[model samples]
Target chain A: MPIVTVASPKGGAGKSTASIILATELAHAGAEVTILDCDPNRSISIWADRGTLPPRINVRSDVGESEIVKTLKQQDADGRVVIVDLEGVASRLVSRAISQADLVLTPMRATTLDATIGVRALALIEEEEEALGRAIRHAVVFTMTRAIKSKQHTAIEKSLRGQGVDIITPPLMERAAFSALFEFGGDLRTMPVQGKMEPAAENASAFAQAVYNRLVGKGL
Target chain B: MSDKPTFSIDLDSLKTRRKDTTPESQGRVDAAGEQHGFVNREPNRKRGRQPSPRVGQVHAKVMPNVADEIADEAKRRGVQQGVIIEEAWVLYKNR
Candidate 1:
């Protein structure tokens, strides 16, 4: 019954990718899910519509930062799992979603600039908790990363740990399969399960599955 | 006197003329099989031990009852609903 939210302040951080991919896997696993697209870009909403996603996956594009809490409260009352895809930056709505989230997954690229902005988002979450007196479950993940760790990646991870922030390992690798996702409007699970596939597609699918497991837990 | 006339129904007079018909209030039994007054105030004597750590199971319990609490919290803290719930949960969970 946890509501997971993907939020970040900077663009190109794989927020949309993470949201769509994880949601797709969960829906495939037979869970009633409602994905609220808070981004004005409407990327996830559009993808769902364009691809005619499975019936189990209900997409709500009308959601915004302002109405998310009440909506989630109502949905929680109805016993539906809520997954929010938040827009970038520290907007009023983004903060509200983070405040309401059972787990706030903030995605950042493996770069100094991304990690720097991530600290700001983490700070905002902490400040909101202090001022509002609500406990918000939160974690950070690095996305669109190369296989090999760079000096910047190690430093950023260490810095975040020093700040006492939770960060998930196994950062998502940068690959064309993820980029191709927006075009086909399909995620890894929806792809051919048996046929031979490109290396990038296989890697993307593995990465997506790994993330899905971490979010929902082992059996899922 | 003017052709137009005005009449008023007297609420005060009506109240004095009605018979009382309320059901008698009943005392509620606590978990320890002890009866207590109808009000929500704490019992006169300590009852059973505190609840188990299962209190965490009801975190979302606050979300549904938020409407009732929001008005009270807003008036007490002079802050917005988002801030009050957020801060309250943090304090509630840590304890």
Candidate 2:
């Protein structure tokens, strides 16, 4: 199993939502997914509590600094996929989780504040690579995007690309159904009708496929 | 939406690789994280002696003189009134 950690030091950067969407989408695609809800906020647990969890997905909540590495190692079995949703701070827990991550997905909104704070995770990854003497795969995903790309969004995308940062394409758009995952516990298919359901599913599916490509060594 | 092709995952294609989980490697990771200001942020536990677990109450009614004497003896001995009660129980049991 590949351990995919959704991390960003910036709060409200869509870490939980991205984790839930990715886990459910991957599970829907026939992969047994276990989400380690490492955030103190327990966003993933709350979503799981609100409704019946979709098939093939399990969530472990309240994972802290002490148990992160051990938990990741224990859950990284042969027949499952592990997705870790981390807290929104630069802490040792994030570092320890990144150390075990097969792929690190830093989800940030198209804003300068998010990029400034989110870049710290990337720096920490680079430093860990140097210390551990291994290349830790990492990428950035733009979240809460709109159809009409703002000038700031374009500039940020360009800057990140220029720095050789792997940015996942078809960035997760701002969708009503995506936000409603917290309200309705299950995946998009099982949840009640929110806004348009078709495009939301498409966006999530595409994003998960992009992540799957990265996990399997297929460049996005 | 029903017309969309089903997306299937090949479980066998997803390979899990081993990472260094040794104490030395973890120490190095911690050091690197500290350089980036990602220090341990777990909340500190409360420091100090915990409260005693003997929480039962006796609420026995006695004569004023006897209660005063018991209180004086406990204060002089620097022990709780429950200690006096325990000693009295031992004496009664022996008798």
Candidate 3:
């Protein structure tokens, strides 16, 4: 049971969306999973209530700093893969969450501003690593980008890589079906979106598999 | 020998006063089998090569109790949580 924490300092960084997609994908893949929605927005929790979640996926909301460690430990101890969706900005909850994260995923769109702010999330992970006296593994994934890699996307990625950041491949493309997921309250697998559904499913699957491999391929 | 690593975390380390909340008066194992405030010290047994500094940065899925055990061992050994994890990871790899 691993704990994956999706974090970014900038808002609308796709933390909630990535959280949903990963938890749902893992559940569909036969892994028992739980998403502890630590975001105040309750995006994942609301989505779970609004739509039929994939089997073996559990979404919980209102998880704050005080209980994050406990919840992470408990859910993980139960053999449930735990995914935590964190709010943007630095806080006690955010720090506490990162301290316990097995993998800290910082999501950002492809843009100069996003790249700049994404550094803050990476810094937060480093700060926690120092505090806990441990290395916190993390990576940056391009979120809400065009399917075709733009020049800007490549430049930003190259810069991050040069700075020694592990960039997870398979960017979550900008798809109407992604928004349709939350709008209609269901997962990308079963969510009905004419024309956009198949590509969106493929994109989500790619991103999910990349993440899962990164988790498994670590320390080998 | 089983390839699976079964590391038992002391329920007592979890019992230790949480960094956030007030220390509890009663010492009881809750339904979750979590014992807060109990500190168990096992001799620091060195295993394999010392982990490189980058071991702290590697990310992967691991058993949940592994993190707890490392956290507890960090406290017991007066080392960083990452150090314990790095050592445990090397041991797991070599196991």
| Model 1 DockQ class | incorrect
Winner by TM-score: 2
lDDT of 1: 0.61
Better of 1 and 2 by lDDT: 2
* Regions more than 4 Å wrong, model 2: B3-5, B52-82, B85-95
TM-score of each model's chain B: 0.26, 0.53, 0.31
Candidate 3: segments with Cα more than 4 A from true spot: A218-220, B1-95
Q: Specify the highest-lDDT model's number.
A: 2
lDDT of 2 by residue, B37-63 (tens): 999999998898666686666779999
Superposed model 1: Cα runs more than 4 Å off: A77-80, A192-220, B1-95
Q: Write the per-residue lDDT of candidate 1 for residues A5-120, one digit (tens) a residue.
A: 78777787889887876666455544556888888888887787666676467888867543666676656633335678977755655655665666678889878888887777
lDDT, candidate 3, at A198: 69
> For model 3, how does the per-residue alpha-carbon lDDT over A56-133 read when each residue is reduced to its tens digit?
777788887667777766665534467889877655566566666778899999999888887876876665555455
**Once all C-alphas are superposed, what RMSD does model 2 give against the true structure?**
4.8
What's the lDDT of the predicted structure labeled candidate 2?
A: 0.91
Better model by TM-score: candidate 1 vs candidate 3: 3
TM-score of chain A of 2: 0.98
Better of 2 and 3 by TM-score: 2
